[model samples]
Target: MIWNIYLIILTYFLLGGIGFYLINRKKDPLVARKSYTKFIVYFFIVNGLFFSITIEPVVFRYLAMVITGVGMVELIRLFKISGYSRKSFFATSVVIFILLALGFCFFATLNKNLILFTFLVLSIFDAFSQITGQLWGKKKILPHISPNKTLGGLVGGACVALASALLLRKLLGVSPVSLLFLSAGIILFAFLGDVAASYYKRKYEVKNFNDLIPGHGGFLDRFDSLIAGGAWVALYSQLADI
Candidate 1:
């Protein structure tokens, strides 16, 4: 299992690196640099996630809590920086934090294989979406909300993600029908989660939630899809009794 994961990560990084390099080679040096930085940051995030899930369950639980706590802090800071009154959102913020924390904790408790499968799908979707969008994306899906999101990117990402999911069907030891549903759920929710986060950023008029991450906006920005996608998976697991 461990070897499979290691191979997956290595292969993904190699493929992603080639795509990024090809796409960014002709761009402005600064823009290309930023894109590479984002890739490196994503690499670390994936590794961190792998570590969290592979560690002791008790420790993973606490790590999830800590990451969620930081995300909440970042959320609050975003509001404050945007000139929003904290008191107005105090109650709502608290509830969101609680739910997010619980979501992460829930993720920590999921089967390791399931967790890896989820991450792998998201990674494929995210990488291919951005790469394809930048390369060939012509139709903007939500120009007002997120100009970078394109129909081309969406289709490309979903296709690649779904293909990867189908290829790795053995990861979850589930029926083909179940795997299909799970992949669709992850892709749909992950995309929605990203759009939802973008909606807030548009409202906030902030480029990023914070500058904690070099290329990725912040903790919340980086993990928004994971939180939402994981929540969907958790709910699906219960409903499907997986």
Candidate 2:
């Protein structure tokens, strides 16, 4: 456990810290940099809370409920403020909220290590995508939805995310077969999640979700991939019977 803690810290600093800096430090006003920095802080805060509350299972559920509550409120506000009022959309929101909130809490309660490690893997994918896209991306995959996303970045992110799954296989305690599944999950779903968020942003013409997280836009902005990825992971775990 102690050594694993060290490993987690080292991985966060090496991959997340250096990777974020390399990818985001060239901005003119440094908004990206500030956002990346706050992401680090937010990461710690969330994981700290997760680990600390592991002793009481209900605490995790409570936190999940609180998050869902906030999300519900945010969705309502978004619809109202954005001048969108549809009963079916609101119903869809309720369904999504239930699935996400309960599913995430179930994972955290089931295996802290798995869930936390999954997050790190997502970060690795995101960092590489951002870095590779900015540095060498040429062919835009779908410039309409997300201008910055490129073919190179998507390929690079997937490859690196798969590589990371291999490297952290023992830490995550999965076999070669399971590794393949999760690698695909992290890459495919994470990309979809991010792009989905980007599409919503484009549709709404909103720069940042809420500016609640300093440089990271809103809580939803920061957790977009995690939200999508978590639901997928939970479903996969159940379906695979693993």
Candidate 3:
């Protein structure tokens, strides 16, 4: 079990390195350095969270709380940087959203399989989205929000996620139909989550979340997709258990 996870982590980084290198090959040297640095930080954080949630599932709740607190701080900082007063509606809405995500994280801890499912999709879907998008994307998906986002990337990401699920069906011990449905959910929710995060950043005129992870913006920036996707995954996992 542990070795399987280690391999997943290794695969994530290997693909990530290739994708980032490909995308940033022509960009400034600073970009590549930052990408590699943030990759290292991301590697450790992901490993830490995975071990806690899998080996010691009980710790997931506490870690979820930590994630929540960190996100709140990062959001506050982002608001300040935007030089805007905190709107009550925006604050309330976001607080509710974040809390809802935490609820999913807590619930997922009850089953190791569910927990693994959440993280695996997040990792695979995200990396391929960028890699495929850069290589074949031509039309923008959400040009108004994130100019970099492309329809081709979205399709590519979803396809890769679904294909990856074929292999996961064995480990998850589910029928192909069920796994495909789950993959579809991951693709939809994860992309929406990422878009939601991008929306906020664009609204605030902030480049990244908070620069917590060097190349990757702030903590919220990295976990934005997880926050949203977790909410959706929680429902799916619950239904799967039924």
Candidate 4:
């Protein structure tokens, strides 16, 4: 688990660097140069620390949650410096972090089977959403802000997520109904995350979140769905007894 987490963080940092370079290539030379370097350094430091600390036992999950919350606040501040309003952006980030913390606490004592299922469902769905959105998107699903998102992509992503969850459930010998419900919850919350990110970008008149990912966006960009989906899955898992 520790090595897996480390590899994931490393991959994120590498991809983020590539995205920053590509996006900065055609922008204001000075601002691009400064912002790209600063963003990469801050993102690496914060996320590296986050991933490292989060691999501890469940007792330390709260600390990881707090670290992630603080990192999110810093991200909001960066967005504010890039011309976003501190009020709404910070408020949203706080709410999201709080919800995530509460969700973690809620499932802390739940059955490991259910908890693992919830986590797997959300992770797979969130990843599927982004991959599908980027690879095959054409018609705008939410044209006002997220013009790149397509209806077809959403369907494709959702199907893939659902399928992945079912496959994992079967492989792990878990409850199929529980997996399906959890997958459904994740899909719903992932959509909410996508819209929330879109709304945030539109409110601030920004194209992408920090230009940190090639064809993707920032940490928030990739993480929005995961955060929301994870929160929802945690809550649902707590409520359901499977």
* Model 4, runs deviating above 4 Å: 1-67, 78-93, 104-115, 134-136, 170-175, 211-217
Model 2: per-residue Cα lDDT over 1-242, one tens digit each: 53575565466557656656665677755677575767677667556544644446556556656655665565566667767856575567567656766676666555665665576677678767776776678999888988889998888877777787777677567788887787688667778767766765665567666876665666666666766776677777788755
Across 1-242, the per-residue lDDT of candidate 1 in tens digits comes to 66686787789789889989999999999999999999998898888777766655556667667767787787777777766654555557557656756765697688877877887898889888888888789999999998999999999999989988988888888988899889999999889878877876777787688888889978778877777787788788779877
Clashing pairs in 2: none
**Model 2 vs. true fold: TM:** 0.79
Q: Mind giving the per-residue lDDT tens digits that candidate 4 earns over 87-188?
A: 776677667656764665555445544444455555545444544555566677688877767776688668876876765564336477766777888788
List lDDT for all candidates, in order: 0.81, 0.68, 0.74, 0.60
TM-score, one value per model: 0.91, 0.79, 0.86, 0.62
For model 1, the run of ten residues with the poorest summed lDDT: 85-94
In model 3, which regions exceed 4 Å deviation? 80-89
**Which candidate ranks first by lDDT, i.e. highest?**
1
lDDT, candidate 1, equals 0.81
Candidate 4: residue 46 lDDT (0-100) = 45
User: Which candidate number maximizes TM-score?
Assistant: 1
Candidate 3, after superposition: displacement of residue 9 in Å?
3.9
